[model samples]
Target: MTKQTDSMSKQVETNKNAGSEHPPVKEHYKDSLEGSENNSEGFLAEVKAVKRFWSPVWIVPILCVFIGLWIIYEHYSSLGPQVTLTTSTAEGIEAGKTRIKTRNVDVGIVESVELSDDFSQVILTARLSDGKEDFLRTDSAFWVVRPQIDKSGISGLGTILSGPYIELLPGVSKESNNTFALLDAPPIAAPDAKGLRIFLESDEYGQLAAGDPVLFRGYQVGTVETSAFNHETKKMKYQLFINSPLDNLITENVRFWKDSGVNVDVSAQGIRFEMSSLATLFSGGVSFDVPKGWSAGQKVANNTSFRLFNNRTNILEREFKEFDPYVILVSESIRGLEPGAPVEFRGIRLGTVIEAPMNINDEQIVKNDNLVIPILIHIEPARFTELLGEQFNVVEQYEKGNIKGLRASLKAANLLTGAVFIDLDFYPDDILVQEKQTFANYRVLPTVSGGIAQIQQKVMLTLDKINKLPVENFIQEATGTLETSKETLVALNDTLHSVNQLLSNQSTQELPAVMKTTLHELNTTLEGLQPGSQGYSSSVQTLQRLEQTLRELQPLLQTLNQKSNALIFEAPATVDPVPKAAKP
Candidate 1:
């Protein structure tokens, strides 16, 4: 069998070298085997084909490796690296296929995120961009904060996912390094900042939660974080957070109270106060007050973790310091009243009430409780409100000489209702304008007022007393006076009556005859005395002669009469009755 196999192998090798279609071994076998001759040629052809197929096996392996490398390169160059940017949150970001680009050039891709071993931060595995790895900076800051802006301002978050990023802040120097430092993600919300913590003892907070406002001078500068009762002290505690810069303005002298809504009010000098706003309407805030000419501002020492301050008081202290303010509280006595309530001086509202009570209650000295009321009022300084007025046109009013600075007064709010509001005004009767126009500038004025109701009552009572007086008494007194007058008149009347009676009693016939005889005798005598007849001429001549004779005789008679006058003068009449003034 060995000899035969060797011979056949030698023959097959010789056919392959010759490129013969049929090997010698096959022809030799066909000669010995008669029946298998038809299959021999086919078998030899197959063997030749098998030998040719061996050469390509090494080349096939080489070709397969080349195709594999091409595929890997295509995916790596286009898809970039798989990088994960871990942040505090993933709210606004996409994972997995999320891309990270440097200068808009794709640098990496997000793969997946997982909690780090320490659980302090999230770990992200990202494949770096191919050779484009200079985007990471060492000093760049990263935050997961979202931008919030609404009448306030804007903030920033490092990643688009509302999550923090491992920001690479590059140094100015051109340097290169290979190590990585894991970073911490920013917090979702910051811890309590430095601010005021108000301790309130109230049961008014039912649905009242935090995020409420704390206002100062009409401006909102802070928000509430929580409202709860302190078990230790049995009081309501409110944790308020305010901006850091403004916290320094608070002081210990400030007083805080819940404010009620503002309403139209009156003050001295016909002044009207106007109030409006939602904060004032629903939930009142705390306010501050200070003494006139006193400074409520001071340097604040941040001794503790937070500093508490009152906003309204700070505002009032700053804005109203140029003017005056009257301090007054709202109570049951101040119902239907409000801030800006009139501080009327005379019939004018010179100022207004600055505040009011939302609702308040009171109990008996030792008994009843469960009381509720509507509103109360608070007055600014009388002088301040009166001077400010509604429009606050101080410069114009000053020019008119109607008022000047602060003065305390009890002014009637309304004449009809007779409600009263106390305030100060500028009508300082005689205080020098540039000198003592302000009450704070001088000694406090004494308060005085006969209340309108009291005065009106007194006047009405006087009228009623006059109306109620007895008419009979008045008539009796008048009659007494009439009687005295009648007595005086009676004497004169009696004289007239007596004379009238005497005249009336006289007989008219006798009076007429007597008067007629007297008139006739007087006429006869008068006629006889008239000069001018013949006998009268002769008598005239005779009278002239007698006149001459009498003229001569007069001297002698005068001498004799002188002696007689001497004799008469020597003896005065003794029997003559003394003349007396005649009596009626």
Candidate 2:
């Protein structure tokens, strides 16, 4: 068989060299057998014939085929679920090159990018890796991640060099979805992060933004996750995330406020500057704390709402409870009585002024016709609410107290500082009754005459009295009196001069000696009328009475010479009260 195989092989080789078809099998075998008899060893003669369509030599090509089939299967099987995202614009995206990532992990690639039917938005079709199709759920969020700088802070910095990509935040739901609207910017904080979300509402947004820190005391415990303006409420709503454990600190009574970077206060105490943190200076932040004097309330539920105060004091002032309101009708200046000023009962503050002073015009004049300053004051019962008990309503109690002479007045809280506050007290006699007497809403609290007002009124009255005095008439009367006195003094001086010349003459000197002798003779006769004599007693009594009469007449004569008209017109009584001497 070996000789036969060799002869056939040789014949086949000669046929391939000649580039010709093989001869007939009968002739070829005959030629092969003849050559086999002359061959040295017959290996083919010892081998048995096997009937198999597939041979061992065919294994190489079959294995290659199997590998090719496997590669094709894998190419299709490994392909992920396709998702389409609609974006505002296709500025930074490129088909087949852009990728989708979650927490920086590459999970998908963009397959194609096309504009919508309306050309208003760009649609992105992307293929997510196998087994990740479950991530596309109802709550799934997708946004284009690119370098962005906003009031919140710088974000997507990694995309600066690597180009833009789509970011995905998987939802918590079991359900799945494919199509989604792309966000213009990334979500403030990842929704899937383990934490709690609470909302805050404010009238002003200020520098607050997403990704700003949420602080407890001065340390950052969480962040402001998202924010949106609510038109219905006319407020800006913010979503705050507090990381686990620390979130336990939040209670129903917790007060939240914006950390407006730098805190500066210029007061009589001087300027004070404080900063919560450097991060807050850039991105701004939200801070919260349980207000003092209030118990830690119940643990807050997720998405609980609270007010976002603009300053720290506002949060601290949350303790005030406005259960009632009263209008302080001030006639004096309210220069320092601004809104938010404290309203005190005695020295303790019980409430605050919620609104600015309102002016009330009137045709009727108060005293000197001054327009009254009407201010709306909100009085909180919380300060004394507990003392009054829960059964009693503060508004009702105030109305009752008002009838008992509870009044509101403005007083200078700080004279040097010019700060004024409302003082509520009981002034029974000075209860200013209002024309409209009803406690329907805010009662009009009566105001007493302030100290300053009384002083002003007294000064005005004194000036009026001074204006009514008759000064002109008095001056004329005094001038006439002085002229009469001048004439009398000139006449008296002439008489005195004449008497002096007569006494200086030689004959007048002898006349004074003769008068002295006559006086001596009269004295000798008077001496004979001794003590205890009726004549002597009568003389002494008469002399004493005459001296007393002269002394009384001296003041009467001086007044008669002076402004006698004043004594006649201004005296309380013109009739003489001094009794006449009795006739005995």
Candidate 3:
């Protein structure tokens, strides 16, 4: 208390000095100090009344904590659906590097790659972008896209530099899926492609497979989507997709056939060559078209079914509806003849051979006396309808012609191939005719030995005649003639020996010298008669003298022809003629 009072007195003394110097200033300063003290007290009061919830020093760390939580939420919210993919191989795939793409746009990334539990397959876990979750639909396809060369063509060429990636083909299915089996190859058609889908059923697989082209005429407009063999039906079933607009070409009457690309047909008519394109030639293809004389029918819808014919000819052969069946009994060997061979009228195909040597058993052959083979053939009257008029009935005509010597004969269709066809023609000369015969419940068409069979029969008959000749008597006569010939030969040998002996004689040896002398003399005579020889010169001189003498006798011969006594009195007529000329 004493120290506080001393300090207060000192301050009062200093204030009194300042007040003595400036009294107004001293009073103002005392008032201002009192107000400041009050303000300071209020400030202290306000500071004491407030409560502290957090420290400013912790602002950074607390903000960091909340920011981290927000970041984590954002990360989880941005993530797309995760999918599992199973494949046979892990080639060209990486856990984090490989991407999933659709239409060349990346939509996801492979999160990890691992083997299946059995280690038989590769499993890929992939996460798609937020909005791309729809790509995981049931019908969607995933395949590893890499550089590949195949019969279809070179594909995924862009993967060569950018590296292989997974391709996602979004499906049209409404259902979604998280797990999928990767395709070994790319699908032939996009899942969402607008087109008509049809099924083809075939007995033989042939060269058809997925990715083979489907052609209309010769233009490719679609692809074979799938080729599967059905075990239950024992037939090959193919799924096909025809692009829009062109898909309209498909109709009920249209027939589908395996287009081997190159069609080479060799028959009795000749060789026919047809080729669609080089692309089809290598990969094979299917072609559809309405057969001749048929309407295109109604347009086919998606999922429609059709029968796949083996070839165009097979389709044509089965197109006709009305036909007549007949059985022909052939005695000739049916070698080179087969089912499906043409039954022709003249040269035109009027029917097809349903079966050759039909239903022949060992017992039947043993009991049969003639050993004739039965052939079943069906003649389509439609083939002759255009030629014989629409009213033409093949069955009635065949029945009528049966009595008029109509016959079925085996004729070689192709000489080189030895393929024979049934030839129906009239044979009025045929003697053995059974007009009302029936074989195996079918009307019989009379048959004759014709074509190569007729030639063979004639040859056999000739051999039979030759075999029946008088061989013993002919041999005896031949022996006598041979003896006479031998005697003649011996006489000729004797004559030759006589000639040899004569040639060995001296006179005969001199005969050559005589012949040589005679030849030399003849040659000399011929030389003397040549243009520069003495005989030629003498003949020329004689001809010249005779020509001059003939010229001299010309006037005398003329005078003798005019006068009877001109030989004795020719000099008088010349003087008389000269005197008449002088008077003129």
Q: Best candidate, lDDT-wise? A: 3
Q: Evaluated with TM-score, which candidate comes out highest?
A: 3
Please give the lDDT score at residue 310 for candidate 2: 77
**Superposed Cα RMSD, model 3:** 16.5
Lowest-scoring 10 consecutive residues by lDDT in candidate 2?
42-51
Q: Where is the poorest 10-residue window by lDDT in model 3?
A: 40-49
> Tens-digit lDDT track for model 2 on 9-102?
7766676688765345446666555766676664333322355897789999999999999999999999889999987888889998998999
Measured against the true structure, the TM-scores of the candidates, in listed sequence, are: 0.26, 0.57, 0.66
Ranking by lDDT: 3, 2, 1
- For model 3, the local distance difference test gives 0.82
Q: Rate the local accuracy (lDDT) of all candidates.
A: 0.48, 0.76, 0.82
Q: What is the lDDT of candidate 2?
A: 0.76
Instruction: Tell me how far candidate 2 lies from the true structure as C-alpha RMSD in angstroms.
Output: 21.5
- What number of clashing residue pairs does each candidate have, in the order they appear? 51, 1, 0
Better of 2 and 3 by lDDT: 3
